[model samples]
Target: MNNLELTDNVSAAAKRDIFELQKKIGAFSNDEGAEEAFRKYRLTRGVYGQRQPGVQMIRIKLPYGYVTADQLVRIADCSDKYATGNLHATTRQDIQLHFVKLADSPQLWADLEDADITLREACGNTVRNVTASATAGIDPDEPFDVSPFAQAIFEYFLRNPISQEMGRKFKISLSSSEKDSALGFMHDVGLIAKMGKNENGQPVKGFKVVIGGGLGAQPFPAQTAYEFLPEDQAIPFIEAVIRVFDRYGERTRRHKARMKFLLNDLGLEKMMELVQEERTALKNKVYPVQDIAYSWKNLGERVPLAKEEILALADAQLEDSEKELFQKWLATNVFEQKQKGWYGVSLRVLLGDMHSSTARKLADVMRQYAADDLRVTINQGYLLKFVKAEDLPALFKALSQLGLADPGFDSTADITTCPGTDTCNLAISSSYGITRALEVMMKEEYPDLIYNNDIKIKISGCMNGCGQHSAANIGFHGSSIKNKKLVLPALQVILGGGFTGANSEGQMGDKVIKLPSKRGPEAMRTLLDDYQNNAYEDEYFNQYYARQTKNYFYQLLKPIADLSEVKDDEYRDWDHDELFKTEVGVGECAGVMIDLVGTTLIEADEKLSLAHEMLAEGVWADGIYHAYNTFITGAKALLIGEGISTNSQHSMVKEFEENFGKTFYPEAGDDSKPFSQLVFSINKNEPTEAFARGFVGKAEDFLKNVKAFRAGQLAENSIPALQELVYGQDS
Candidate 1:
């Protein structure tokens, strides 16, 4: 394995993760069930398979979208080194670099971790990046900053044992305030900052909590779990929730596996009861997060302008056009900070993509005119905080020079879109192409909409909702319609979906109609024109949509959806010269579980080794959890060898007892109980050193028995060995 030549300052854990990835990549070809096994492993480390073969997309996790200028420069450097020179900001507040070779993933990860940024758990069925409002700390309406709390949640779950191998991906959000800028209602756990008075009349910091929200083909609004949950118990409460999810979440039916499904199946009351049952095993009852806002000072090599130069630039005159553009930008993108005279500036990144050169320039701009704190917005833009009011002109000039100072920051023109057909396997059409066309049309025709914040336009390549289309006032997802035998790319028009500035009652767009990909621009124009002509004065887009009704909009757009007079270009999807074809591959937005008997046992052995290593490092909780995984993996291996379907951890436990509890592995020993009891003990006992040691010992004995039974089966030729199953016998 090739090791990184990183400085001693790099984290030991990061180095180990990289080394493990390299080792796995090296051994992949020889392992049985390698394709499925390796795919699951790499995804947890943030290396994802792209739509294009022989390349991967590396997702760099930026918790709460916070990035320093120096860190931005580092990311740019890595983008130039390991990927195409483009950096794509995702709606989840992550930076994704595409076209990375699988072998280079380890070094790319190492280079990123060298700058205190991580790729860990960035993509996978693990705890994804914890998001917050881009205006988190500085929002004028916020009760308190949610940055530190978001960071704490991110840190607590990154590589934590409870969330590593869940049945589906988990998402969490911490909105700055009741405005819910982070869209708290769309996450597994949504927390909005709230200040309350205690019994003694002292001010207490807490959150109004919501749980089990999600957006996909089927969207669900989160239920209000608590009106107020004290800040101190945040980590423990989340920990308990994840534990319950890990145990009970679905595995066989991929579509029915999100936490929302689990919540729906077992109601909120029953879910809370399970969470209460697991609280005794939590590591921290009260985790007090540190305030991170104090560390916003610039720390980069870029030089800043002198005080006199800044003053002069602030006072500098602008041309007529430049002045008009600047005024529009100020109206749309600039907002006052809660910290008196300072301002927050949002830079609208076209399609959420910028070249490496642009990123480096952005870093310099951050150092020159703004605080070191750079936030990636959920709308796929950049937010620079703590800019002095006087410095706005200089900042605007600098950003404009980079082609990033578009007037619309998060408006109708500022369309949120995912990398649909360009990189995602699930995307059915070209989101980038359609988004570009819409933006150009909007800029040329409806230039005044840049100042309109009441309407949101969002696009997703598919129904997966990575671009968060379901929550926008106007949304479109990629689809296809057949004309005779030819398939034409289409966009499903959705309307009336939006947040009402209240987390408890968020709306999801209703599907109105589908139009050919080429007609997407026309559809937007038609909607805008209709609203402008018939709506009540000062009415928002959603209100107009509500008034018009779904059938009304369908009738209105049914003309655009008509294929009777389709042009030749209509046969082709956006940005593609070739005719359209529906050729979507398997979606890896959330990696699926595919374990064979042979490789599953090997994985079990590996987990046992990890358990011992954790024990040696005195990480009792981690060790106990690893041992717990060992039990599940070993039991799963035997059941899979028997061709029994393994759907979920909880189900597998029950199935193992029903199938072979006292049959092949008879309960002869005095200490032997049901296999389910041994595994369930993890959540029943505290994670002390003694319990961890004993649990690991029990796991070792369990694995030995499993291996012995497997050997007997092999001797009888009842099951194929790893090599024979993967390759062939009689070499």
Candidate 2:
């Protein structure tokens, strides 16, 4: 679409946001400090810097992976115009467009907004896209549709103040049934639909809540927070937990800032106590989720063929080899839904990358034969819903033409991988390269294993686990081994991790050994060979690993771990001819740390300005939270000037009082209320206009005091690193 057409399609608010982003980008081109600040801001808006300089990757949020045909076409157009003519479907069910010039991001965003799609809060420290089971509405075993609840949470958190500037990114997922198809066990907050009896013994709707789970450098399994929390209380409960996390979660140590760490520190019981303490401060005590009216657009009134007739027609049309392959595809890729006469067809996009032209074709196919509802699966595949059973053959043929009709959907052959050395700044090795090699090996050598759905293989370029390696039955993440003077890229092999599915628990992978990156395919072959020979009938991969134990696998793969026998080629990383040299860049996944005192003070002024803007707009709660951050930024700046670095805002407030309270207010001594008490008043009182104005006034005074204090320190030349302060220091 042209600029005018795009502008006409979006709301005035979205247009303003895109224009402001363009203005900020232009400003940053002239000022390096402004670039650092804008980098953080843009990430929250879903524009992320790729590993390559001067280009960006824009992540588009798709709640529950639901996309209309028109939206897909728009995405394809945007990819063709602004990106590399490709869309990468992420494990989180979001689509990423890579290799776009930074200057074009605003235009790209405007184009997406034209289709009612968004890039806002798709990355950075905000609550990410709320994911749900791809089979939410059609699952036979589901108690109720989880789409409404997931959508509700997505709407509630979009532009919500509580999570906009969190210590780290937050993830929430809703599962349709006990099957946990959404992989709820590995998210920050996981909700599984449940049916329970109220006090009066009537059936009530609720969720089985799990909290604090995460897969990163260190993986943590989520713990149960509630056996059955009434559906209406879900939002309030989540908001309360977020408030507690915002107030107390670590900020300085990026690696230690996840909600999982807070849960680990406080324990589940104590964490729940803190959550309860914040209940009174929540914006809503009970947010009843209204049932969403979801309708599938019927392509045409074509009569569905009977099962016998469909089989007969397929037999007549297919050649012997084609029929055999079609049977395998149907057995592995097509799902019979709860809806009679309908099916869910899964297309495995190799490594989650689909060319723009192919995507446009897929959209056309959906509009012609399916329900026009396309859901991206968590395993980097596409699930086309509500296809007539008879239409499967035609759909398969069309998908085959587009190279998407692969057999294995979520089986071992359907490997999950992250954009490692391909685009991510923190990736130390080439995950995509190794993943391609492994997939080829599996299809060519272990073709019969395509139907094995019990085992999963996942890979990440690093231990950050963006590929969710920790939750796989067999997993690998990038690493390195130093042998004498040579450093070779390596893959850390992990085993025995996977979900048991429906009424069962899951386990995180145990690290077994590290092997050269080139030998990853060989290592996979060995693991599969051993499993085939030793496993009992129908024995799952994790169960077999548990019986054999970690030591056994370590011994089995130990030969490959011997660096003394490494060849010259072992020094090379996958997809690169040059010898491996780890060039890990600073990850902007959680936003960069700002350490310059002056820059921090400038940020405080910005926060104050936002506070005033929010208050003027009558968003009292958001204005109060912004004012609260203003206080934190000013205090942190003063503390940094004193070389007294604190990890969290809570600590910053306490340290400020301890060091400067007596000097600033001599009479109020130890008997006075702590500075935390004053700054944290945002949650103590109702978020009314009077309170918002009062809080903003207090923040203004605090910023003035901090600026004056810093000026005096500069006059005395007491602060160190006057001109050498780095803007992105971690601590």
Candidate 3:
């Protein structure tokens, strides 16, 4: 069946979501108050605000990096119609389209959903796309496929009430094998597939669970939460962990709102204890992941050349230069799959951006000479699977025509970068521009390094690490320097970071020095030249960097960092004609922040309603968590009204007790428990029907009292009215 013709069968839920988005978009024109709220809502549906004012960026969620040929064509068509004719494959295994008008997003989403693709929860504070190894089903080193597990998690969290409005965005990754090709260790939650035996000595599938890992201004390596967790318990365990984070994670301090920071504040032992405490409220103790049977058709059976013809072609190889090029392309870009007589070809996508025309051509190529399925790699590339070995030459020629058959696949010549100043609001310099300069320098001056995969180069617009600069062997993040009266774009050089070996133990880069953005290529050259000349035989870049230390590189690149010798051209940033200025906009990467007292109270009421709904549904754990959030939200609203800012939900609980507990309801039922103690009973009691009902009742009373208090303050003019305060402001 043609995948494109598969049916525009939109699920009722999806239809409702699309309709709601349309309504919100329509409402935004008349009601300015709805703009921020709508922006937040659209983000959860994958409509992100771009650096450009009038347009948006759409991110399409593709679980585990899996894409079918038909889906690719559909995306290409959408890009051509609704956005710039380009598709950017993100490191998280999602595809992004830029320069899309906000009004056209609904139609674009509908177009994608026609092919059963979704943009839901692709961004925002919700659980982002769940990723896994690109080679999951076919990797020779994999113990078993992780595709099903990743898909299960992706589905479970799509609109799960627990994660819809978290303190920060959550990420999850599953590796097919211990090799951790998915870069699992750097995600919010990482799962490594493992095989173990039960008490009866029968083999059982499981995962090595890691938590709180992330890449950002402050990168944290994930700590092992469980050496082995049974497959059946994975979902429930993950849900409990999220519940804990939701109730206790930071809220006001955006910078400290990630799971890693939460884990840092609460020791691993205490965090585990909290997770265990929430298990009683869980909707399921064990969720059995159904086996996924994945099969690919169209594995190119037709050989364009006969055996004798292929032999003749091989023997007639002509120029030594042509022969060497072919050999290099084969060695770097082609790898034998576990399946006999089949190979996987890696297509290096320059900076992860491919024009729609190129994408359609690649899809057509897949329909003819490879499997219908393709996997987008974590390093911003594509892996074409199930190609017949006999078709290698023809395939290379086809890809070469598309400018995708670059000899280096994930080698030093293959640089990874984020959109940076091109489209990211938080960027300090031009990451894409400097990246191009560096790549050209490497290919032109240090061509031999194309074969070296040990050294990776990654650049981020800023220290937020969107480009995963902290995970590179040699990294640069956008920064700036101050001269007497001017500012210049700069790159913060970092060293000694990357995957140490096949086991996937990752090391974060250390900041070495900052240099002018225009001189980034020279800085890279300096580091590579030093490593090449001084390193011992067989020493990898990371090992050599560790031996030389950060000071060594800082001293070597210090000349470039000297702002005293700044030239006139240094005043302009890469790819920019005007003088450099640090113009950063508020980042919506974590979702819009609503600070209106009334808006917050309304959110509290909504949480209360959701708690009631969950209680009716008999989802005890979910109800209890919702009630907990209701109390926190109500208290936060009142506190914010008093001009008291809260750094975290936990701190809000304490602050509310200190400020209002004694003045308001001083005691509760039996034993005269304080209001704070009563509200906190959520974590103390098991998630039973009785406890859920009682906690929800208390939350109801707490919200009522909070509303009454606010009314009295309003009547007395002691607090600013909603209209008096700046409302609907985007943060």
Q: lDDT of each model, Cα atoms only?
A: 0.86, 0.86, 0.84
Q: Give the TM-score of each candidate.
A: 0.94, 0.94, 0.91
Ranking by lDDT: 1, 2, 3
Error of 2 at 634 (Å): 1.8
lDDT of 2 by residue, 403-522 (tens): 988898888899999999999999989999999999999999999878888889999999999899999999999998888988899999989877744356766889899999999999
Best by lDDT: 1
lDDT for each residue of candidate 1 in 537-651, tens digit (9 for 90 to 100): 8777777788778999999999899988888889998899999999899988676666567778878888999899999999998899889899998998889888898668999
Q: Show how many residue pairs clash in every candidate, following the order shown.
A: 0, 0, 1
Provide the lDDT at 469 for model 1: 87
Mark the 10 consecutive residues where model 3 has the least summed lDDT.
722-731
Model 2: CA > 4 A from native: 1-6, 32-35, 297-309, 319-321, 663-666, 712-731
Steric clash pairs (candidate 3): 281-621
After TM-score superposition, what is the CA distance of residue 699 in candidate 1 from its true location, in Å?
1.7
